[model samples]
Target: MSSPRISVILPCYNEESYIANAIESVLNQSFTDFELIIVNDGSADNTLSIINGFEDSRIRVIDQENLGPGASRNNAMRIARGEYMMFLDGDDWYREDALEIAYREITQKDCDLTFYQMINYDDETGDIYENDWFNLTTLDELDGKVFGPEETPGSIFDLSVGVCQKIYKSSFLRKINAEFPEGIFFEDMPFFYYVYLKAKRISIIKEHLYFRRKHDASITHVVDGKFLDTVPAGQVLMRIFIENEWYEMYKFDLLAYKINGPRFALRYIEEKYKIALYELIKKDYTEIKSSQYYSDFLENLGPVKKKFFLDIIASRNYQDFIKLNS
Candidate 1:
């Protein structure tokens, strides 16, 4: 078998119920020039057996002890041979033409990365809703525009932190050593941020090419101490931006992100650790506000966000800040 043009990496962990459907979606893609790398992260269930049931030569399975999804992806990436790489979680599946559309746009536009939209599928309700991060109605206007952070800061910076929504050029990823932070809960935060910074040309397809499954068993839905990983993830992203001088270029977006990141922790973190997480975010905010580019951030904020910022700065306690923001 010749090397495929695209590589789809699916990392599984105890997903026996959905693993077969996910694999079948890839196999059934209209675009056939691809390989599916399935990394089973020590599923204590029947996930491994289901994966073994697929006899297609294009499917390569790597079974390892549970090392988390980030490590599993890194392991698959090392042996990936495709020109472009994409990720799919074990519980999630893709549209049949997803690879075909993404491949066409990326190859035709000659972009380093291509981000397509997704649909959120409610497991219990069986209802689907468009992922409206871009608020775009049609793909006709912005289908093949090749631009990066400098030209399209909002699009680049405001993208969801899920790596599954985008397809990356394998060479570009290898060039920047953009591997996920192993054993981290919010690894996508740092990984996708680094990719956006290093990407030279990015394209967007407004079409919904991926489906995200939202369920109680999903990692992001569970409440645990690991949720606090966002603090360190934010710090790692900030350090990378500062060290590479990207902070100044995208200061406004970064500022908004810094202020809002703690809100996610507040929502998901356990009550006892809330104050510590707030303090950590506040410390980062202090350093960011002290930067020379902070004035630029202030000037860019609208009245509402500006007032929120002032309230945050003036509040003496986390509860007051949350109340003011709320």
Candidate 2:
């Protein structure tokens, strides 16, 4: 078969209930030159069966064991025969013109990657809500111009740490050897930073081009031991910054993230699982206290936030962590 102009990869694991919509969205896209690569990550449910239901000449299916989405994307990316690529989650669908719009901008403006907008779909309520997850004003300020990683300070951390919302040049990704961090729940954070740091130029569009499903059972909502992966996931992010010689420029952000990120994760976890999470956070936070950036973080945190951050770490147990915050 001839190479496709664009390759769209959909990765899913037991997403039987939502896979069909995602498949249809790609099949029904206004741009027809793209190939759809569906990675069935060992779904135990009817997800594979659902994927096979579609009849499209452009569709390619890869059946693999239950590797995480990171591995799924990495595996698919290596084999994709397209000039450009984008990712789609099994539970989410794209706007009909998403590929067309993103392709037009990426090609016309000659950017390494271009990310459009996204709206949240609350599966429970069927509500489609606007999410200004990125600083919208920042994009507006760019005024349709392409900007490099250095052009925007700390931009590697500013945008939504999700890849499904962006379209990347296949060659640029290959050139930089961008691979998602595998075997982790929050791998997207590290991979996102790694790419932005290597990206030569990128564009942003205000047009909403994707629907991100939000539901009770989805990965984002269903908290478990996997949530603890955020710590190591963050460690990966820090290593990327340091490896790229960006630590001094963004260390304050990293220190603040160390302080606030885990707290946010623990808040939603069941009280039963809070202790393990606390132990991990306590160890992580305690170990990093000696770093000058840690001291810089506390020094600049001001009185109120400092006390709040300290109180979280100083807790004797998860209960005290809860009670102190409460």
Each candidate: what lDDT? 0.82, 0.83
Leading candidate by TM-score: 2
* Model 2 agreement with the true structure over 1-326: per-residue lDDT tens digits: 68898999999999999999999999999999999999999999999999999999999999999989889999999889999999999999999999999999999999898878888889989998885673344556775889887777754445688888799999999998999989888877888888887888899988889999999877878887788887778778877888888878877666666556666777777767778878887777776676655777577665655765677578887778767766
Which stretches in model 1 have alpha-carbon errors above 4 Å? Answer: 134-141, 272-326
In model 2, the Cα lDDT at residue 229 comes to 84
Worst 10 residues of 2 by lDDT: 131-140
Q: Per-residue lDDT for 1-326 in model 1, tens only?
A: 67799999999999999999999999999999999999999999999999999999899889999999889999999999999999999999999999999999899988898888888888989998874563333333556688775665555555677889899999999998889888877788889888887888988888889988988887677655676667677678777888888877776777667555655666677788877766765665566578775686578776765665566566777898888877
> Could you tell me which 10 consecutive residues in candidate 1 have the lowest summed lDDT?
131-140
Local error of candidate 1 at 218, Å?
2.6
Question: How many residue pairs clash in all the candidates, one count each?
Answer: 0, 0
Clashing pairs in 1: none
